[model samples]
Target: MEGTEKPVSALGIEKDLNDWLSVTKSRNGTWWHSAFHNVSAMVGAGILGLPYALSELGWGPGVTLMVLSWVVTLYTMWQMIEMHEMVPGKRLDRYHELGQAAFGEKLGLWIVVPLQMMVQAATDIAFMITGGKCLKKFHDTVCPNCKDIKTTYFIMVYASVQFVLSHLPSFNSIIAVSIAASVMSLSYSAIAWMTCIHKGVIPDVDYSPRSTTTAGMVFSFFSAVGDVSFAFAGHNVILEIQASIPSTPGKPSKKPMWKGAFFSYIVVFLCYFPVAIFGYWAFGNKVEDNVLLSLEKPRWLVAAANMFVVIHVVGSYQVFAIPFFDMVESFLVKKIHFRPTKSLRFITRNLYVAFTMFIGMTFPFFGAIIGFFGGFFFAPTSFFLPCIIWLVVYKPRRFSLSWFTNWFCIIFGVILMTLGPVGGLRQIIVQAKQYKFYS
Candidate 1:
């Protein structure tokens, strides 16, 4: 396949591929910038969705899960730093290329293609669903005929908004939006915490005396790890940022990007840990999909939190959409030789938005979507991908030991991924059996 291509069209494809490939070789970004970009990417839907995950494991297991996730994320970040240093100019697209270089094309594609699609699809669903929920909240609060507004409507509207927002002309504008959304989310979360803490409405689930079986312990560990994986799954984004960094005209300093990643992990863990712990402590077993629900806040505060969550979810969708859209664009241009004209870019962007919104509208249950994606698709993408990439790229001296760790991480990721989906599926199926439709 590599040696026998003679078609002129194939030459065009190769040229396009080479053009995209050039981005990987331009090493010009800083660690702090990479960290901020990554944080913006990962901190969205995960923060809103993690509390419910914690509820499943109870307090001790939950706290353990948070810490374990942080540790695993830190380790993964270190590995990512190593990969960046080893292959200084490669992006996620280049990871598969690296895999091909290290192993073979078939093996590389087998791993990268499916994992990439799964992660993006699941993330898109999460963004759409959460966005719909936020819009619903707004609708219920502001509209007189709020009950008439269907979940599908909100999903469609939000999806359209995402498509438009993401397709804006400038990168600076998008960054500005991300910054604004982050600020709003942080402010609202602070207010929600204050409201909840002041009212003393946080629930207390006593899991101190519960028997911790071996299997239970394992589940807790993976679940926590899974949470961390979700929280820190922006290594791809980091690489993208790294690739965007401008190299010196004549010479660039060889600063380790992992130093930035290490500190970024610390900053993320510090931000997430307190929120997860306190949010869980406040709500206990009764924590709802949005942890803010547990807080007995003023109407205005609740409204503010809902708006913040909506903005956060929307911002996340935009961030996720960029890569997904980029991949789509790359495939079309490189594989199909389709030029990315302004009109073509607009159409493609809108198409993704419409498709994602349609899915969200069809499946209005945010919790179910989060559970399914987090457990099934996200688990492997988060935990297994890095390990597999390490094993394949590095081959690590001891093939057997590396293989064992690779499989171990994969198995652990798979289990964590399954629990949420299986449990969520059970709940959905049972509910369907009992009732004709979603209430």
Candidate 2:
């Protein structure tokens, strides 16, 4: 392939390849980079659906579950960061590396890589649809008289940006985009809740669950759990973000990474809570899946909020897409023995973006897809997989507080993983029955 570089020896070949790849070559990131990257990765289109999730769960269980998810995911995220440099002189830079350290090499790769990739891919597809829907929303809000454009075209427009941003090469390279995404996430989230409050509760608004049948309500509740689980899904990429930070014996990466993550969590709290609570409070049980869609009165403000969403997801698509790029590139160079070159990277990245864009256009059921992906993949990776790995690697005393805590998380996470997909799948089927293809 063009621009391929050959190394002098076998050892040189491995090192040379790592250097050529985008992620491994970067080690200049700071704590603030971690702050915004975490914010960008963690706060995404998922937050927009939270009010709808709340509508399914109702006030008490809804609020309680959201708070618990915040606490548990925060604790688990801290564990992932700490484990990043747990091997003293060596850094477990990627999630799979940490998994290999805990489980045997093959088992670790089998367990972690599939789950992580699914989460990343699912998130990217969800963000694609989200970005497209928001673009259409923005257009409709601002120029209602214009001829209606097909959503598939709008999704293609969103993916066009990703086609460019995907080639940025490294996590560090996208720092500026991540920072802007973080700001936009906070801004649009505030706009979502504030507008809801401004509108006040809908006249004679009903707080009742949407489903009338008992089975339907149960499934709706389970699907909502999936949605909430999906909202905290930045765990899959935390180690990757830490991988970009420079680490040494005297100054480990964990300290700065955790500091940055703590601030990001505060941003997560700010962006998630009021939006979930007040959005539901104002709209009651009738809020749209993306809360911005529910408020259309202040045409200019709603349009601006939708534009913020379009920009925010533009950054978010790249944040989630980086790992997918790394994994595929690594596989091509190592397992398949393809030369590391610009041509290979260009082909791999463009194809991946196209795949996600196609999926989003075909089945852009945002709420249902979030619920399904959240429960099926995210619940395991974000909710409890870290605790399981910690127990295997560290073996904290059987009945100690740490062990009990991990056990609790594992049990809770397993419940979510099992039930969330059932509800989400059912909803997808229902939506699909009435939908036209790529309309």
- How do the predictions measure up, each by TM-score? 0.80, 0.97
Could you give candidate 1's per-residue lDDT for residues 1-439 as a string of tens digits? 7877578987775555544432332344465545555556667667765665666666676777667556655565565545654555433334445455455779876766566666766677777877777777766655535457666767776776786696664222365566666565566656655664676533455433222566544444334334445655664444444554544424332243565556556656655765676666666656665776565346666766777777777766665666666667777876797876767678888888877776666666645445545665666655666777787677767758757766667676666676656554554554554432222
Cα error, residue 335 of model 1, in Å, equals 2.2
lDDT per residue for candidate 2 within 1-439, as digits (tens), equals 8655454687587778877776676888999999999999999989989999999999999999999999999999999998987776677777888889999889999999999999999899999999999999999888999999988899999999999999998999999999899999999998999988899999989899989999889999999999999999999889889989998887888899999999999999999999999999998888888888899889999999999988999888888888788888998999999999999999999999999999999977654767888898999999899999999989999899999999999998998899889999988887887776685
Which pairs clash (backbone N, Cα, C closer than 3 Å) in model 2? none
TM-score of 1: 0.80
State residue 148's C-alpha deviation in candidate 1, in Å.
5.4
Model 1 CA deviation exceeding 4 Å by range: 1-29, 85-95, 139-148, 169-173, 201-232, 247-260, 397-411, 418-420, 433-439
